[model samples]
Target: MKKNILYLSLAVIIGLLGGYLLFSINADSTNEDLTDNHNHLETTENQMWTCSMHPQIMQPEPGDCPICGMDLIPAETSAEGLAFNEIKMTENAMALANIQTTIVGSVEASDEDGIISLSGKIAENEENNAVQASYFDGRIEKLNVNYEGQKVNKGQLLATIYAPSLVAAQQELITAASLKESQPALYKAVRNKLKNWKLSDKQIDAIEASGSVRDNFPVYATVSGTVTEVIAKEGDYVKQGQPILSVSNLNSVWAEFDAYEKQISQFNKGQKIKVTTNAYPNKEFDAVISFIDPVLNNNTRTVTIRTTLNNKENLFKPGMFVTGKIEGAIHTTENSLSIPASAVLWTGERSLVYIKTNPNEAVFEMREVTLGVRNGDNFTITSGLKNGDEIVTRGTFTVDAAAQLQGKKSMMNKSGGKTMTGHEGHLGIQESNTENKPNSDLFMEMNLPVAFQIAFQAALEPYFKMVDAFVASDANQVLALAKTTLEKMKAIEESHLNKMENSHLSKSIEILDAISSNSDLKNQRDQLVVLNENIVALAMNIKTPSETLYVQKCPMANSNKGAIWLSTEKEIKNPYYGDDMLTCGSVIEEIN
Candidate 1:
């Protein structure tokens, strides 16, 4: 009985010990799992998030951006050793954008092997133009040259006239001839008077030999050329020195070209130019620059350059389009680097280009450059660049856009900061994308024609309708209204607008075209701001507005840079932010 009791006690102890050992193993496993979970929670809490467009918005946890309502992204630190204005781009991004870099190299002046292209039209050489006029007042008895383009020669019989004055003078000559021995001085004076009337010696001798006065006289052409205009018709009386025919000698013609004001220094008289015409594509004619207008045309910002081309074959006709290629001799900039115009971007008063700072990486930075005269498709950089420097010559705008989105110094944003993001579309709002837009001031005193103002005002009517659609956040309505606006803009007559005003209207129409076809509310609204800039300038310059149009401004719109829009009513209805901030603008001017 004692042995059985001890064995039962040992078995009970072994059961208790085994149970304790199992409980301890389970407790250790549970503690390890709890610690691992805590570490994972701490790691998640430590990661901060930020909005890509609004880098200023930072949060410990991922969520929608408070300012733009965009999805939060993990904030990335700027590349090490990068300047405040410089931004690094991945090789994949550069390849996708097709960004190409060109190393600055010196090029010989366009005069030496390079051709400076010029466009112009052929015109009649004014120096060779002449007016065949009547030397004496007489009625046109018969007209030999009937129509324009009739070829005539010098001293050819142009017309026959019955001149009462010349007949009376002829009779005096006849009478004076008879009494030559008694009145030799009178006879000599009468002959000299006939000579003064442009009478040839042979005709005078015949009159003397006939001993009779002829009533009708023959009129001859003074110059040989094609008749451009028949000034006097048959049976019409003309006064002395009155044009009977407008003649132009087509042996030579003028090739007139307009040189831009900026390129005035590149041209001068006596420079050789190679001329070609579309009609004669295989032929090339050589000519020398005969004249260059000293005064600049304020309207076109160009000066007239003329060259004389021999047209003996009658190849060049007046008003025919011609192209002139002059060897650039004056601006022989030896060390200056010529860059493609595509490499440059202009915003407001600043001119910019992107420089690839790192040779091995796709890092880039914005550079402000002073441009010299443009030769063909390239321009000389007077400042802000040097030889061996690498620049983005192609896909420059793409690089600028990347810089803008990455909050680096860009053509649009001189000082780097967050720009508008796509998230604005989520709330049916899209702020203006204008970068340093020009002032919307009235130039009413410009005195554009009243007809033009009326037509332009009609164009603005549909723009106001578009604004209403934008305020309602109806993308379809915006598209329809934009199309209507584009039609109105197309109908605007550009004959009355000056060069600058025409440029404004053209850009406005281009933007309208984009807005019309776009279905995205954000992009359309963003384009709308750019369109309004041109539209407002045109509205203010309206010399005679039929009705009052309000010019309203929202200083907080367009990422706090401010924007303007035209409205028929003085009440503010913000299109950038619909009901969110309906009246967030104020009228700055009443355009009329």
Candidate 2:
């Protein structure tokens, strides 16, 4: 037994020594590997942090983002070898943002030949218009061409009229025909009177041969054209010489253009112009200015210019929008550079553009351009730009956003955000050059298009009803109203919104969908905090001031974070707290 125990102990001792040696070897290898790569690894103390939503918030340590109240992530190193005025963007970002660039050209060398553009809509040519009038006083018994846009041919039966006077006249014609041998002069006079009623000689002879007095007479179309209006309906009495139908020769149309007072000098009667419409973007219709209004419109500061277009194929509609381009005076290359109007951003009194700094890479910088004159869809840069310099012609706003995220100057004015009272958590994205005073008209400078404003106004009406539902704390009603409001929002026209505002609108839709699915009041209100950010941003910039909207804020809502909702009334009806704090909110801003 002692010999067996000694052998086991020796085996155990050998296993322990082998394990120790392997551990020591691993420890030494790990130490060498780490020490060798220590220089390459980034230190935790030196790491920077930034927000995913608001990339401008950069901090030295890991914490929640000050702007969004979200956890920060390690910041990516910026592109090196860039000038102070330049900002570098990745190729992926450029493609995703749809950043497009175009080389600036001289106004004289442009394909448009520095054309002066005029905005107007297609109108019916009045020169070839004719009115179908009744030759005799009668009541319309039947109408063949009843509605507008009906085609009518010359000599086609338009309507049948019932006339007692015509019946008496027809009786006289038969009597006069019977007594023609006795009173030849009287018979001729009676025949002449019947001829005066626009009756053909055959029709009068047939009536006399049948020896009958017809009460109904047929009226034929005097002109071949489209019926524009039906003045006299069936079973209605029409006086002699009264218009029964309006006929317009639609083989031609008028391309009426509105020229601003500044462009009036460039236009004259008999000037040749190129007219185009969205329907036929690839085609240009040549026309001559037929007329120019002698007086300028005081309300619009514009004058009317008329051109006639051949529309034999029915290509031009009356309400179709059209543009008239007239060749404008061209300047030398040294005089000015022409760039697309989409590339320019107007901020306060400054016109800004983004220049593609690198020819081979995606690097951009902001430029304050001196705008000279706007010609057609292009603008003339007097001094700020030079020929062959590439600029952002499309997605200029997206480039501006990228520049903003990179801590670079952008088209957005260095002006501060709205510094409203009562905790503006969502609106606290401070600009780099705010000078410590926030401009209350934060979104006023956004330059929302009239089309977007009109659509948003239509959608916004239903949102107030949804707010009222929230104020009543009726979750089911809120859900129904959310659906209704969302339905309205789906119809909103987003083509006119800028890139940033479009993004805001998209996010608002997502939050609203979440709010619609949930029944909990707290959850819905929580989502409202984010949704209101987008809505208020749009509201502050609406160019169409139709009504007085009170922007009421409740600081205690959104879990101590403030939230706002627009109201048509001055009274505060708290949507967040309902009856518990119905009047807890205060008016922060009023959108007129």
Per lDDT, the best of the predicted structures is 1
lDDT of 1 by residue, 155-245 (tens): 8999887788899889898899999999999999999988888888899889989988888888898899999999899889988888888
TM-score of 1: 0.49
lDDT of each: 0.75, 0.73
Q: Which ten residues in a row have the lowest lDDT in candidate 1?
A: 422-431
What are the root-mean-square deviations of the candidates from the true structure over C-alphas?
Answer: 15.2, 17.7
What's the TM-score of every candidate structure? 0.49, 0.53
Residue 71 C-alpha lDDT in model 2: 83
- lDDT per residue for candidate 2 within 32-59, as digits (tens), equals 8898668445455545566565454445
lDDT of 1: 0.75
